[model samples]
Target: MGELFQEAILVSILAGMIRIATPILFAAIGELVTQRAGIWNMGVEGTMLMGAFTAYFIATATGSVWLAVLAAMIAGALVGLIIAFMTVTMRVDHFITGLGINLLVAGLTLYWFRMYIKGRAQPTFDGFDNVAIPGLSAIPFIGEILFDQRLLTYMAFAAVPAVWYLLYRTRWGLELRCLGENPKALDIKGLSVSARQYAAVLFGSVMTGLGGGFLMLGFSDRFLADITAGRGWLAIVALIAGNWMPRGVLAAVLVFALLESVATHVQVLGIDVPHQIFLALPYLASILLLMGLRRQSRQPQRLGIPYFR
Candidate 1:
């Protein structure tokens, strides 16, 4: 009985780690694309909040998770457009533009959320159900941890490799990468630098939005203000610590997720320590990891510098 209980706890923790990874993983992977193209979008947190809010509103209003997801992607795209316009067209400082967007989104979402629930009880909706892969899901310990998850969870993992291929193997990717390393090179070749950057920013925002949508539809029943917490910031840190590589980003996200899972399980296990400490583990780890890894970062040379001409 003791051994069985231990195995169950282990499985639960690992499973929770994967589940927790989904949202940040999506954001990190998508941000990877944006960064590689030289746009350092700092509005990931606000964009994610908007996505979650959009998903929650659509899900509750229409009772359709898929529709909510679509809506979230749309919201993300709109945010991306704003970021692109500021950084690419208006030549605003990328950091300031991103921070401004974050502030704008935070306030906008709060006001909308308040109005949404005003004079009415908070609404809730059914979230996604896990789809256990046959044969794969039936295997021993590894199966459940790896194969039984919501559809979006599987998509998030798959996105790492897909993004890798897009970044490293494709022609469009080469041009996009050139935008980061040498926007002038693309300009000299008569390529449209601004167009590609806009696409990249939009892609990242849409994915971040999808991650937010999943954070809502895949986990929570209702929305709350600041529902995204700091996962968006974590995604940015993962990109830095991972040196902007897909595999490395995935590794960083998993580490953070594992810490979060441990934090979550601590309450269940009734550890005598303060839950706040556990809750702070991922952020603490992020600070430590960034300190160690920033020196090794292979960041784009032109990243965050607004391109001209």
Candidate 2:
């Protein structure tokens, strides 16, 4: 009985880790593409917040989770367009533009949420249900952890390899990657640098929006102000810690997710320490990871630099 209980707890923790990693994984992999195209979007947090808010509003209002998901993507695209306009078209400093975006979204979402719920009880909706893969989900321990998850969770994990292929294999991907290392090379080839950067930023924001929606739909029925917490910033940290590679980003996200999952299970494990310590584990780990890996960074040379014709 004791052994079975321990095994069950272990499986639960691992399953939780995968679920927790979903949102961050989605954002990190998408942002990896954005950064590789030379745009250092600092507004990921704000974009995510906006997406969450949009998803919440739509889900409650429309009674359709799918519509909410779509709305969130739209919200992200709008935010991405703003980032692109400032950083790519207006030639503003990327850092400044991203910071401005974060601030703007934070303020805007707060106001909108307040007005939305004024004089009314908070609304709620049903979140996504896990879909177990037929044969795969029936496997002993591995199936429960990997094969039984929300549809979006599978999509999020699959995105890592898809992104890897896009970044390393295809022609358009090669051009996109070139935008980070040498936009001038594309320019010399008579390619439109702004176009590719805009596409990259848009794609990242859309995925980020989807992640936000997933966080709301897959995890909670109702929305709260700043519901994304600092996951967006964590995603950024994961990217840097992973040296902007897809596999590395996934690993970093898993580390953070595992820490969070462990935190959630501390009480069940009969640990006596303060819960706050467990809650802080992922952020603390992120700081240490960044410090240790900074020296080994393989960041793109032209990243965050505005391109000029």
TM-score of each: 0.96, 0.95
Model 2 segments beyond 4 Å from truth?
1-5, 267-270
lDDT of 2: 0.91
Candidate 2 lDDT, 1-309, residue by residue in tens? 243248888899899999999999989998999999999999898888888999999999998999999999999999999999999999899899988999999999889988999968999998899999999999999999999999999999999999999999999999999999999999999999999999999999999998999999999998877689899998998998888899999998999898888777876666776667867877788788778877887798899999988
Q: Where's the lowest-lDDT run of ten residues in candidate 2?
A: 1-10
For candidate 1, give the lDDT: 0.91
Best by TM-score: 1
Badly placed stretches (over 4 Å) of model 1 are 1-5
Q: How far off is residue 279 in model 1, in Å?
A: 3.3
Error of 2 at 60 (Å): 0.6
